[model samples]
Target chain A: MMKISMPRWFYQLASPRWFYNFTSKLLPWFGIATLVFLCVGLVWGLVFAPADYQQGNSFRIIYIHVPSSILAQSCYMLMAVAGAIGLIWKMKMAHIIAQACAPIGASIAVMSLATGAIWGKPTWGAWWVWDARLTAMLVLLFLYIGVIALHAAFENKAGADKASAILSLVGLVNIPIIKYSVEWWNTLHQSATFTVTEKPAMPPEMWIPLLIMVLGFYCFFAVILMGRARVELLEREKRSDWVKQLILVNWTQ
Target chain B: MSFFLAALKRELLLVFRHRSDIINPLAFFLMVAVLFPLGVSPDPSFLSEVASGVIWVAALLACLLSVDGIFRSDYQDGSLEQMLISAEPLWMLVTAKVITHWLVSGFFLALISPLVAMMFFLPEPAYPALIISLLLGTPTLSLMGAIGSALTVGLRKGGVLISLLVLPLYIPVLIFGAGTVQAGAMGLPIQGYLALLAAILVFSLMLAPIAIVAALKISIRS
Candidate 1:
């Protein structure tokens, strides 16, 4: 029988301790990047970007709304992928990442909903509508809440991880169907409401800040995820020597 | 094949022995449909306008109500552990359970939906579409709901949690199911909606058992 050897980094990455150390080094960079990009993007988008011809400055909400929505969706994909990795490889660290992702993703989904509603009141003359995108986001919120609740219901940690993994994977399958159906329903209803993505093309000034905001949101997600994952790792590993020593060191410092 | 047949028979026997387990969801379906007319309007025109949606929503809830028990008793009685440890493929056993569940819950819901539809004053032309859509749509509901039931079978308060996990997944089915009857009511061809519902049914039928098996393993293991 041949023994297959994996790369050293693969094993190291699987270790929660190694992940904690590696992310600690990377966290400062992500935090700085997130701050810089968000500050620049907000200033450029709010004060400098060209206004919409039809909606005027009300469209500025897109800077926060679109990026958070994108983050909300991507965060779910990331969480599910982490869950799959955990299930297939039996990696505790991966499960930790998946667990940490649920609350952050849920909060981001809420932010998207809030910003969307605020934007809606000014532009669409109503605080709410069954517009396809909005309805889809609302469903996305429900999906997030479901995953979070399922995770919380279990007293056993491993069971919670596997259960939520199955759920998020199930949710992953539904997300595309939800997206397409909402779009189809929108067309059937012919609401003709203004959609952020409807414009054929935006000039550089408009899209440039939008691009910056999107990047900033991704960086922000990384910072929060790493921070939460580290906390989870510590809690799970509290009785371990490394965590104890780390705590003692911090206390001494 | 014999093992599968025996498992199916066992499930059916258990379900038939508890007659109210079979009747409760159907009664819920009828009662919910009754509520719609009183809550909305008593006018035939108004009830007809919302008839397909009212029936579909009621059916969806009833299916959800019944699915939590699909694996709960088996888990509680230790039969699930026995089945899991057996040499038989778990998915095969899960498919059998899911089939029995649909027969009792989804199929019965579809069969009685016409009576419930009458409460909402659904039009004559829409009756066939409603029945067909429920027939096609409810199996997918049972299949999807089985996964939720399997996941939460070991939990103490799994009923509400099962709804939370399953309802969002139920949206596509509801959309197509209601759309079929609505299209039929509007005198439009409903083949597209029916086809979509059947597609979903087939898709869930093929894939959902595998998820159910995995979730059952996790739930039972812990």
Candidate 2:
């Protein structure tokens, strides 16, 4: 193991045990923040937020759709970056984090798509559109699914991680291209009138809750990502002495 | 330079020896084109309207099917490992491999696409557009699909999984390819779409081999 001399934080971040212990300390705070922000944000957005001038209450789906969509894209970015780190540094922890991201990101993408569909009915008068944003989200879902499928297809965990890491990196490079081409194709053919991607000037009353929801979603994502990564770390490192000691301590307790 | 030529020659020789390796996907491409008429409509007007899209999609899928031809045999017989360990830069070897892939899949498909165009009653002007777009687009498709093939070369049955992994990446190529042909059919300016397709080709040519080499290394290492 030739580790080029690097900063302490880099090595610390590369260690699964360090990550588990550190995240365990932060998890409670993230969990509480997720709970408070989500509850408050949902209540604020659902109740206090002013109804859309045109669509009335139907626009409320934005609280869910926008947050999940934002989270989905960010999750992919994180997964790709983590994968690059894993591939470059041979860091098992980074691989675990990237693997943890695939399913969660896919689920979030599905949520975003579902909420967009639900919102589309009242807003666009249809359940779906080949609009640029919608099509890109669908493609994102497929990319996430591809990463998961690639991971599942491999027999060895290390190979699975490496294979999927390459896929995620490839996908990361393609997302913007896919979004642009889909937009170009949409405008060329569909003559779409109402673009959901446009953020019209919303009053603070409308946007504040949306902002809170976005924050809540990020916190919630972190809470889940950390928990998932920690569990994956435990499983991958189960053969290690520290993990065995930790497991025995927990069992005795 | 010589390494690339040698690699290309080897691949060309191999593909020539196993002729079905070249014929199967072309037959599959023709079959897919046939399905558009049978499955959709034989009406000339409707078929003409969709002809570009139908041909481009069929070409994309055909290229995808042949992508395994890029690395599968090599992986199976362990030449992939040998290549990985070789002193020659992996990219040059894979680039030769990809060029050979495009020759069999993209080049021949473009050469024969006019026939598919005529069958679908595509207008005369669009034949050039269809051929050019397929010519430009399918190389990118082959390059991109090679990455998927390299990644999945380790898997036993990577068939549908390869489609799942590669098709999204193919969308830009598909859009520009079909759109260019559609533009030609409508007598609209196709230069813009053709330019975009070429840009995508250049972009993927620069990057896809790097990804393919990396993916092949991953598959081989694992």
Candidate 3:
């Protein structure tokens, strides 16, 4: 029944140096966890789980499709929040993290689009239908590309960072609009099957593996993002003595 | 409001002084509309059916063509910076400039819309809907475009960059604007789409100036 106060250093962890060191230690753990969970999730979902009565084998794509779609949207939300923090606190670390997240987010979006198309060919009897959900997802992908391009388009890093941050904030208008485009219009796309409160339509056996895949994706995102941030930190803080000392110490170690 | 009027007057004078800038986008709009009939089925009914989409797309392109003009000159002359430091709030000035922008480019696009409608054989009644939709829609374009313009003010070759930034954001306006005309063409109630378009215009009118001011500050600083 005892409680202990955490050290000030715990809160100071927002410092890139602290984060780089902490995340360096955690990266390998997340990488291993990601790999272990990914293998288990893929095998369990693809091999062990029973096929759906309607979709049959094609339903298997859901394991990848749904996870990628979820990550794509969640990554945007993450970047927007990071951008907001960067704007508010003027945190360089937040900006770096936001910049790092864009490509990973865009690739995830592309995968969602590709997987949706693949799943569509079998399920909807068309490769693409211009459905609200599909179109919105496609638009989300474009928004990601737009943010990435805006970031790259400028020579001044600050300009790129701020511009991309604003674009990310503005494009968020589309996310809600996209999510509801189906409901608001009489579109071909079905309503959201995944809800927080209600049980998913798929059984626990299937959903559990899917859940693992989602966790694995998150771990993978962390691993890559940390790697990118470490590189960014070193690059941005290259002139600092601490970086040089850290490099020298690492060499000596 | 007076500032808005003054900015609009200044913008119109600039457009008149450099009239050649107007022709390219208007030509681009015409060419794009012309291509639809060449690319798609030339059947009258089909063209008429999709006329709103064609006109709306062309209008989007035309507006995009002019967005760079909104801030590029001011940025080049450093007037944007001066405005930022002046007693007049930059947002009001930017809003005025955007209003002027719509008055020239968007207004031109609206005037020529009936011709584009004729190309698609749109019925007489749909013509008014086309003008009404653009009247409500084009100001939103200028407002939104002002944000893009402010963002890309200092960049070389900002024309393409501005389009990429603004076009995705233009989707809702396009949807409701075209939906109004489409509804009119289909003999359905156009009230809903028109109301939505008007609401969007109002919303963008309120918010875009502030965003433009922020962007202009950032642009001027860098």
Candidate 4:
């Protein structure tokens, strides 16, 4: 196989030591951004954002619900891409990132499903419905749990990483088909479907805060992923001198 | 192609040596389908309504029952590692293996589905639809299940874990397979549902062997 030349920084990013140093420097900024954005976005969306005429106050849960939903899917995409990169380059750093992604993505998926259920109560008049989107999200949660379980089942770290990576990438391809099929199934069984939740168009007042919430969620995700990856990198690379040095310095200080 | 057939024949011979590998899933399929009626109302009208879904779900589980065994015997016996390192392309061998899995599991499930459907009081019009949908849909199930089987073949409790990995991926096929039969039951056109099942079959056929090959390497190396 021909090797494609990659830029110097690509290799740098793949190195665990370089990644630890770089993220250590960048983590604080991401943390601060996460805090600021989340606080502002939550306050604005939950407090100031105009409510849906049909559902009134209960509709406000969309502030958290929509962001968590979007981020949950994005997290899967990130996990799969990171897995792909790790497999292609055999990069420990990439696998760490992918490993770090599973729990966070799974938790975020839970948050979305929970929030959606909360919103569903007042909106759909039920706690759960086999709606297309909800069913797809439920399957997404199962996919995440599978990845996390597979990763844990492997006694070997390398095997765990590669196996879960392959699974997640396979999931990446199936998700759309799953989503589309669920949507089709929903249409076929249209009795339980609700048209009430469909808003004509979001007023800028409503969507602007949503945009902010989405941004906040993305920042929060980046902060958490980097934080987890940093810890994983250290744990996996503890025998390396730089990790040992960093631990020694941190412990002493 | 000859190599592929030889590899497939080897897998079939191995399964035949332990014949339960062929009968267990079919028996499980029969029992599971029976449990649905016992758990739910066995009233003909009610059973007829849910029969399509019941059969599809049961067949899916039966396939899962056997799929983990696809690589388990080979992994335990040391043949999987040899195949992985063999000069022959691994994906071809994997495809052959998955096909045998389908032969033992999916193909037989399709054959017996109408018997279960009759027990569920499935409409006479839907009989052909049930068989065709299962025929088209089961290979996809086998392919998708192979990825999970390959991933977990080395684990002591690979069977349950295979379900956790494979069942979620099986949803589309289940939906379409049941939909085809339900459409036929309702005297609606079955073409659309069959097409969807065939589409999923094609998609999985193209991609799943690649994932299986990758997963088998990961499992073997670990």
Give each model a TM-score.
Answer: 0.96, 0.96, 0.93, 0.95
Query: Cα lDDT of all candidates, in order?
Result: 0.89, 0.90, 0.84, 0.89
Question: On residues A16-96, what C-alpha lDDT tens digit does candidate 3 reach at each position?
Answer: 888887887898899999999999999999999999998889989988988898889899998988887787668788889
| Each candidate's interface RMSD | 0.7, 0.7, 1.7, 0.5
Residue-by-residue lDDT tens digits, candidate 1, A145-237 = 999999999999999999999999999988888777767666422232224667627787888888899999999999999999999999999
Q: Which residue pairs in candidate 3 collide?
A: none
User: Candidate 3, A187: how far from true, in Å?
Assistant: 2.6
Q: CA lDDT of B179 in candidate 1?
A: 88
Screening candidate 4 with a backbone cut-off below 3 angstroms (N, C-alpha, C), the clashing residue pairs are none
Docking class of 4: high
Taking the tens digit of each residue's C-alpha lDDT, what string does model 2 give over A139-243?
999999999999999999999999999999999999989989999888422232223696547788887788889899999999999989998888888899999
DockQ, ranked from best to worst: 4, 2, 1, 3
Candidates' chain B TM-scores in the order shown: 0.98, 0.97, 0.94, 0.97
Clashes counted in candidate 1 amount to 0
Off by over 4 Å in 4: A1-3, A187-200
- Which DockQ value does candidate 4 get? 0.94
Q: Which candidate gets the maximum lDDT versus the true structure?
A: 2
After superposition, the stretches of candidate 3 with alpha carbons farther than 4 Å from their true spots are: A1-13, A178-186, B1-4, B21-24
True-structure lDDT of candidate 1: 0.89
lDDT string for model 1 (B1-222, tens) is 998999889888988999998999989989998997778789999999999888999999998998998888878889899999999998878989889988987888888888877877788899899989999999999999999999999999998999999999999998888889999988899999888888888888887888899999999888
lDDT string for model 2 (B25-101, tens) is 88999999999888878999999998888898899989998897678888888888998998999999999888888
Q: Write the per-residue lDDT of candidate 3 for residues B1-222, one digit (tens) a residue.
A: 787678677877888888777777788889999999999889999999889999999999888887888788777888777878988767767767887788777888899889999989997788889999998899988888888888888788788888888887888888888888988887788888888788878877887777788778878887
Clashing pairs in 1: none
